[model samples]
Target: MSYHNKVVLVTGGGTGIGRATALLLAERGAIVAVNYSRSAAEAEETVQAIQQFGGQAIAIRADVSSNEEVVTMIKHIVKRFGTIDYLVNNASITRYIAMEDLDAVTEEAWDDLFAVNVKGMFNCARAAAPYLKAGKGAIVNVGSIAGMTGKGSSLPYAVSKAAVHGLTKSLAQALAPDVRVTGVAPGAVNTRWWAGKEEQMRALIRHLPLDRISAPEEIAALIAAVLEQPSMTGQILTIDNGQTL
Candidate 1:
């Protein structure tokens, strides 16, 4: 599908992959709604950058973990843009606890990660389904390689992403024929997500066949490709620089 004049809502669009996707889509003539729960400044910066480039965009604040907030966000986007064409479920949270540190994986940690990473995707998809179906749009949920590998920064984080992958497939079936649903499972990338964990990231890079980490722009390109592919759905594409291999 052509991105020209399309209305896309990208959750957690203030930074990282979300920001990159927002910028790239806007460049392609999509009216982007950059959503952020707390990173208001970054979201606004994304909007400003798009505007500077003669693209249309807006920075919206909403916590994807909140069903009410997600519903309201979708409503606001549709009301402003007159229609919704695409949705990017990219908001997620993770704890940096070791997988073996069961004691550190508190109930609160699991709840927090699942709430934002798994349930958040569901809330956004559920809220945006009608609008997407109406316009025959597509939804891309950002998953993680951790889901497939069963390993990541934390056990809860890995499990939550696994749930995200499952949700992506289920939503694809539920929203079929009208709206397409797909997922991108990316491994390590050069983003603030690796801040303070730089050592760990470097160690991981040494082990990758690509011998390098992915850039947010690279994943953003993959996401755009996934969104544009007319015959793809219920699939999780991985771009991990060979981390899993």
Candidate 2:
């Protein structure tokens, strides 16, 4: 669908893929609602950047893990924009513990990762379902290659992402015909999430077939393509610079 004048809600839109997607969509005439739970400053900066470019945008604060907050956020966006046309579930959290470090993978870590990564996506999709259905909009959930390879910064993180992939397919089937649901699984991008792990990232790049890491803008472009493709749904597209290979 054309992004012109569309209203899109992008969770965790302050930075990384979310920020890139929001900016790209706004450039295409989408009115973007940039949602952030903790990165208020970054969200505002994104909004400001959009406005400077003559695009309409707003920075909203909501913890996607909270169903109530997600519901409230959807209502607010609908009230302000008069309708909702698209939703991007991109908010996620991960612990940097080693996969083999079972002791480090505390109950709290699992709970925290799942709460924001998996359940958070669900909350956003569930709360926005009515409007999305009404508008015949689409939903794109950000997943990770870790879900497929079963390796990432932490075991809980990988599992949570796997749950996200599952949720994406289920929502695609459930929403059907009206709102298409899809997912993008990106391997590694240069985001704040990789801060302090530069050495690890460099080593990973050497192992990748492409010998490079993906940029947030590249993933954003893929997300836009997925949303625009009328014939696609219930698919998880991977853009990992051949990390899985």
Instruction: Judge candidate 1 at residue 153 and give its lDDT.
Output: 83
Error of 2 at 235 (Å): 0.5
Q: Mind giving the per-residue lDDT tens digits that candidate 2 earns over 1-245?
A: 46888999999999999999999999999999999999999999999999999999999999998999988998999999988889999999888898888988899998899999999999998888898999889999999999999999899999999999999999999999999999999999999988888998998888999999999999999999998888999999999998887
Cα error, residue 207 of model 1, in Å, equals 0.9
lDDT of 1 by residue, 82-198 (tens): 988899999988888888988888989988999999899999888888888898889999999999999998999999999999999999999999999999999998999888988
Q: Local distance difference test, per candidate?
A: 0.93, 0.93
Q: State the TM-score for model 1.
A: 0.98
